[model samples]
Target: MAGTGGVRPSHSPTLPSQLGATFPARPAAAEIVRDLPWDDTPLGPRERWDPVVTATVDLVLSSPMPMAFSFGDSFVLIYNDAYADLIGTLHPAAMGRPAAEAFGESWLSPGLGGVIEEVYRSGRPFLEPETQLTVVRADGARPEQAFFTRGHSIVSDRRGRAAGVLTVAAETTQVTRRLQNLGELTSRLAVALTVDDVARVVLGYALTSFDVDHCVFAVDDGNMFRSVRRIRGEMLDEADERLPPVWKRLPDNPQAPLVAAARSGRASFVADGEPLREVASDRHERRIRALAVLPLRTASLSGALSIGYRTEHNWLPAEQALLNAAAQQVAQAAERARRFEAQHGTAQLLQRSMLPEHLPELERFRIAARYDVGVDGNAAGGDFYDAFRLADGRLAMVLGDVAGHDVRAAAVMGQVRAALRALALTDADPPGVLAGLDRLVGSLGAESRNEEIFVTVVYGVLDPHDGTITLASAGHPPPVLRRAGQGGEAPTAELVKIPPGAPLGLGGRWQTGVVRLEPGDSILLFSDGVVERRGRALNDGLDALVAVAAGAPSGDPRNLCAIATAAVPGPTDDDVAVLAVERAVALSRSDTMLVAAEPTGPSRVRQWMGTRLREWSVPEQVIGSAILCTSELTTNALLHAGTPAQVHIDLNAERLLVSVADTGTRGSVIRAHTDAMSSRGRGLSLIEELSDSWGTDPSVRGSTVWFELLIRSTSDSPAS
Candidate 1:
């Protein structure tokens, strides 16, 4: 088997026994290596003797790295004990087999089989960079990881022909995982912002990156460690049940290492039996075998971050470090959220204080008012109501709802309410008051039209003297009037329909309407909300109100107002304002004086007049008419050129008077029914009918027309 380079053929039967004995003999090696290239002559101990060949075989077999042997032109390879372990019981007797034949389909991966074949064909060393491969175990149930041999090569023959290939390799799973973890850590840290966000990220990363059963971060909020972030195999059911009651009772208990460590700005690690001792009575200890409590510290405060394990296991230093960083980041974020809530609370308080304290009193009127600013979790709303007396002894009242529900709206409400009071006191008409309010609102630089701010108002002036209420409505519901009477057996209620006017700032013609208030009458003024509820028509609400008012007990105006307000269901989403005015009862007629006078006449006539006055219930403070009429007639007959004369007197309920007359030369004095002049003829006539009533006797004087006047006194009337 020797080649042309003077190399003897080792595979031949004529080959020297000494050279054959130098190599460890595989059952087929003697025949297989017979065509080798190297000389087998004994060189010294350093050069290759039988001992050297034996040592080389020992070295390859005993090396810690996985080693394998491949014969010429074969896909299978024979592996030693170390290589067999890497293959995990796959082909336990894998010796003298081609690598592909040994692992079957697994060895068919690209580049692996090709490289091995090239090595055997060329009889040259071929280096395969660190390549990964999957090798099936003997059970064929799972695959084990292995790294392919780097730089596999073969021993060549004298003519550079293919012979056998050798490979060396090791596993690199642990190192690869470490690099991946580092990458994940960097990514998580980059996006962590707030405390909750950091806790969420850390817990999420631990669950996904480490493939743990569950990850939870219990944040110590001074008193208790609240489970803020939790990632688990199953959605957490009754997670709190997993926590020890003692931990909850003493959230900041100094004796508790987790809490103490966090509050003191220190990290505490508990594992296995140690955690059970501190939280022995805790029910959660049974489920959580290993626990690490890390203190999250910012400059001002410190809190605890806890990690739990369902199984007993030791936590690695890397895991602890990652958790500690995450906890610290979460602490800072918690502090920020707390500060924001505090500032917001302060703003809300200030806004609330700006609202009105109480409603004012108005004589002979009932007023109910409410201010609701519709601001939730924020500042106060901008709605207000006011009732006050004007300088003219009149009541001035106003209810206004601003456009917004924020602090800005509240401020604007205050300004608008104040302006309304000032303008109202100045006796400005309703439209004038609104115009002034608009001007003032417009002047508030920041609260100008750009803010789209406006207010709806109902302003009124009530004169108690005549029970007259002059009101100017600006985009407000017309005040309802419930006259004190029954619509049949039920009390009647009517929405006092009036001319509509534009709301403030809409800029239009505004007119005020006057309503005379009779005794026992009521006037209702309110914001739209009191009569308007969603899902219910406004008319329906009005009807309900009317029904309630009709059923309510009668009392003062205030009582009626209360009943009306209670009729509406809560909550009156917007502000509500009601003003009621009732006139006082009138004075009795007897309390007034009456004046009466009858013309002087005969005693008989005087007697008749007295009888009439007495029957009419007239007071005794007048001069009798009969005597006066008689004296006048006698004087006219004696003092002037006269013939016969006549006298008459009359009296009645409201007035009394008398008249005397004289006759002319004609047959009888003709009484004129429609003439302004006739001296002697009219003197008696003027006194006749103009007085109560008068007549003439035709004995000496002509006929005469006379009257009596009765005067009735004037006085105040009571409430009807």
Candidate 2:
């Protein structure tokens, strides 16, 4: 024990404990204490160390617990390997430094160094159950939260005087963070108004808390159970990448772990894979070797959270308690979401029941309608549309919007729509229909003092025989007209100007406007939502709708309706409703085909066009030019747009017009000044040279390239 109590030379770096004197059972601990040069600090050399210091260092390093000792007035520090892990990056370098110096900014903030100093000065033991600390991991640059339950005890000198402090710490960072997140889970679940929302909040919390491979939240769905799951570091499908994880439904067999847990109303923990084989419902579940299924059971709802791992794991008591608490919150949220969905569904069903489920299908009158809900899908929207045949052999179409987004609004809309239909069946005209609807809304508004019922509507009557439509507007956006070109004129879409009447709630005189519907012409009636943006003027949206509808492939009612409804580019803050009706073009004189985006598509178009033209008795001279121009346009669409092209041709009494449309990112066709014979850029040049009047119109999805050819007369010249 020569180097044990006296100072040793620098060359002889080994301490007495290295030769099995003090730390005989732990050579690693002795080496850690022996490596540091004690002669440099206030604590002096190892050989000159006091007996109390020797005993204390032996106790600090040998213990399995995270223990550390700060000696004398300077509080020189020495700690064990367990303590090294607790401090993260503060280890090794902090071995023999003073506690205050080594602890840095955290010394005064966490009050650990001050507490230790007090313990050494007063020779009294102090214990703190919970204390917060910030740690920067050795492998990471970001600082993370940590907590500890530390106890400081006094270490006395041989003279019975207060000499140093001995500290023992238990890091509670994991459990503390999990508990904090659990609290956050409750707050987040409170706002979860739907089942998907609940699943999103619960699944995300479970995944982070357990450090498991995956987690799923399953809700009872009668004979089936719907589960929304998330896996660590997994790439989800684009369609499934949204708020509230997408759910997959499975059989509600009692043998399944999640199902069993929900039915048993208790928490189930599986320690091995063999027990899970029968319980797992799919390959994903079968991979889980260990599992914890916590049932979320309440008076109103029943569900289970399945937390799993690929490797076997033991669930701790603290973890079980936290998971159980989380399950309770999930159950409450599930109940709330179900209630909201139920009420929302009832309102939606009520409104849809009032509207015509199927439109009147007639050869001459082609109608299409679309109704879109607002951004908040939790509530039923007030927008509605209907197409029906009147007793007088006329097509009646109506598009209306009530001024709210709740059950009350939907109820008001249903009453107004139903009354209008009833009045129409009594042979009322467009003005009479509006007059009845306006009075009905006025009465409903007076009946309900809770909300002021306001509505806008455009109702129209189409006479298929005469090809005329009479429309009436009640504080609604005017109907747009898509007119098919006559002679050599190009097709165009413009708003049908009509005198506006006051909205339904405020009484005003209603009048009708007559629109002469030519063959292949479309009439579009839409709600204010289609033209009223959040910040922009109503005229801007109206202009955009006309442009979009005109550029649609043809005067097809379905295409026109879809194009007009999606004219606005942002989220729909209010409900959107649109209805379109187009007069049929002669089937024998018109043709439409979808050309695939492939190399052989142009050849297919050429062959098909030649056959159709010959069958229609078109002149050979015109047929040849039409085929070549159409083939060129189809080829351009395949090359530039990289999408399938919609090819449409209409032969009227005065002209033959052909159009090719595609949906690609780029839009609008600019005039190209290239050689007409060049192979690469000759598509447009060929179209301009051969056709009477050729142009391109850009649409929301892509562009339409069209050309008009003047025909001599309506004749039955040739039959191929």
Candidate 3:
């Protein structure tokens, strides 16, 4: 063949001898080239060929490499037999056509014609090996998009001038796609946070990218192997029950490929077996042909991950290594999740113990409480609430918050609550109780914590008989008292007139505030957690809480607490505690009984209590505690105070309050009586321990000694 110059080239004769010897006799592609109808194409006749064009053609035709000669400005395509198979269906018709017309649209791709143009203009050879370029090819029978690695160079004329570009290429689509998929799988595993997250990423990617039929991640649960996740193609399914629950200790069964892998802690391949097939659903058993399992090993445990194929697959070292890397990633992530779960459970247990086991009850009153820890905090927070009955037939509610969200702060809060409860029992005044709490916090906190701890609290004593609440605040939010309304009118929540004192741990005297209420009234006591947020003003949160309380059902104490806590708009950086009390009814004469205060007063009180409790169907444990506390109070008044004493027993659905009034000015005090022999000092000590609360009130005429017991339902009582 010759270029279309209408003259025989100088090297034309020598090229034809070489072409004739290689064609028809040596190469099938040369025969296809010789028989091509050049006159009908753009290159014209063989006699008109340029020496450089004909010489380049001879070289390309005789070469065994996959090479092509694209001649002239149009890049006329002329390729050898190796190159013919490389282009697949584009071959026979592509022999003498332009480069763009031969490869169709892909010839103009940046990786192809663009490189050729650069080689033609620069007159320099361009070489790129293993570089991917998408092209058309036939995989078995149908044409498909494929990848190739190609090298291009300038074809020089006899006169040493560039004429065209010659390219040598090789197909690499399968190898390239596999490497790319592996790279993506590794990237996805890097970002996985938990065991399930890693399993989802690796299993889903392997099924689709590696053309696998099934993937399973099984974790070791000591006694048995538990499948964390299993995927069949694109669908997620439960593990097959027929598979071995426990990995085999020995590889005695050659039929069990997954068991063998687990026993050996190495990757195993099975071309055909009932073990792998039996693990598949009945519908997919016939479709599965091969399986591969990789052992997952961590410092604490061992497991196996399996990948199944629909068609028989030859084992490759690279694929095995890829699966092993994935297994390691999953092992680390699973360990992380397990440790986090354990720590979370421990913190939850500690917080639960710090809260009240059960709220104390008062007659004609309902008590509800809630506590929420900060979402972002890792340790238990220092927010707590407690409710118990006082000596004067009143309910005492305490809500407190210690600064900081750590174990130390929680410990301080526990100490403060215990000390305050002890002080409140001996003293009748809320402000006096808080003042003693400040001194106790200063003394007890110094040894436990190096850093200064601050605590805020709202303590209220609610008299259900009179519907009056006396509140004391220690750098805490004022309690809201909601008055009941009539005629479909909603209740209104108002901040009580309490004087805010310095927070506990700082020495300052505090004052008490009083708020009078009616039956059906509700009082909400909360920590700053209910009203404090990051970007908002404190007053806004307080106002929002009031609104939520006002609109909430005053009759339901629990519902009121929920609404008030939820009123905070955003994340609460501190713990929140909401304690609410609703006055349901007023106490009447029927609720009270009197007994003459004498040496026999204690026994008489017990007899009356047992009878009343049996009639009301109160729990046996509550009745026992009530009778014991009443006896202690009556005995103390008879011994400590001079004669002319009287006993008043008050009963309500919530609690039992017993008061022993005497005409003596002698004040009852809590004195330590650890001695085994001393009897006199143990009276008030026993009253403080047995009763929920106890106190003494003095006047010009006499002083009254009182004690209270919390009522319990039958279900809340312990076995007698």
> What residue runs in model 3 are displaced by over 4 Å at the alpha carbon?
1-72, 76-114, 119-214, 232-263, 269-274, 277-290, 309-319, 358-377, 389-394, 424-429, 448-451, 462-470, 478-498, 513-720
- Give the CA lDDT, 0 to 100, for residue 32 in model 1: 29
Q: Which candidate is the best by lDDT?
A: 2
lDDT for each of the candidates?
0.51, 0.72, 0.65
Ranking of all predicted structures according to lDDT, beginning with the best and ending with the worst: 2, 3, 1
Q: Any residue pairs clashing in model 3, and if so which? A: 2-46, 2-49, 3-48, 3-49, 5-48, 362-654
For candidate 2, write residues 1-720 as lDDT tens digits: 000111112211111111111211232435768988889988899888878988989988888777888887877888886665456544566778876677665554434455666666677787755755454433334555567677788877788887678788777888888888988998998888778778877877877777788798988776567776777776543323331243456566788778888888988887776546875645776788888889988786788988889888888887788888888878988988888878755655565565666678776666767666665566777888888888878888888888898877887888888888899999668777787887788787777764367888888888889887888889888899999887757789999978888888677888888898888788888887777788888788989998887776567665666667678776668877778887866532667999876666788898999998877778888888899888877766765555689998876444577889887532122122111111334567677678766666433345677787766655743321
Deviation in Å, model 2, residue 115 alpha carbon: 3.1
Task: Itemize residue pairs with steric clashes in candidate 2.
Answer: 5-47, 6-47, 6-48
Residue 99 of model 3, lDDT score = 69
- TM-scores, all candidates, are 0.36, 0.65, 0.54
Error of 1 at 517 (Å): 27
lDDT of 3 by residue, 1-720 (tens): 111110111211110011111112233678877888788766678777778888878889998767888777888888887676555445566778876666555554444556676778898776555533223322233334455556677878787777778887656776677667767876776665444455566666667666777767666555545453344633222322211111112223434555556566878777665445544434565476777788777776666778877777876786777667767766676666555545654664576577776688655676767776676434788888888776766677799988888787788888888887787778858888888888877876687664377888888887766777888889988988787786557678878889879988688888888887677678888889889899899999989988877775333465566677788788887877888887764441224445443455567777987887677666677677777766665555554453445666555544555666766533222122111112233446556667665555432245566666655453543222
Residues 596-713, candidate 1: write the lDDT tens digits: 1112222334455456545544545444343344333333332222234344333222234344444443211111210111112223433442334333322112323233444434
Instruction: Give the TM-score (vs. native) of candidate 3.
Output: 0.54
Q: Highest TM-score, which number?
A: 2
lDDT (Cα) of model 3: 0.65
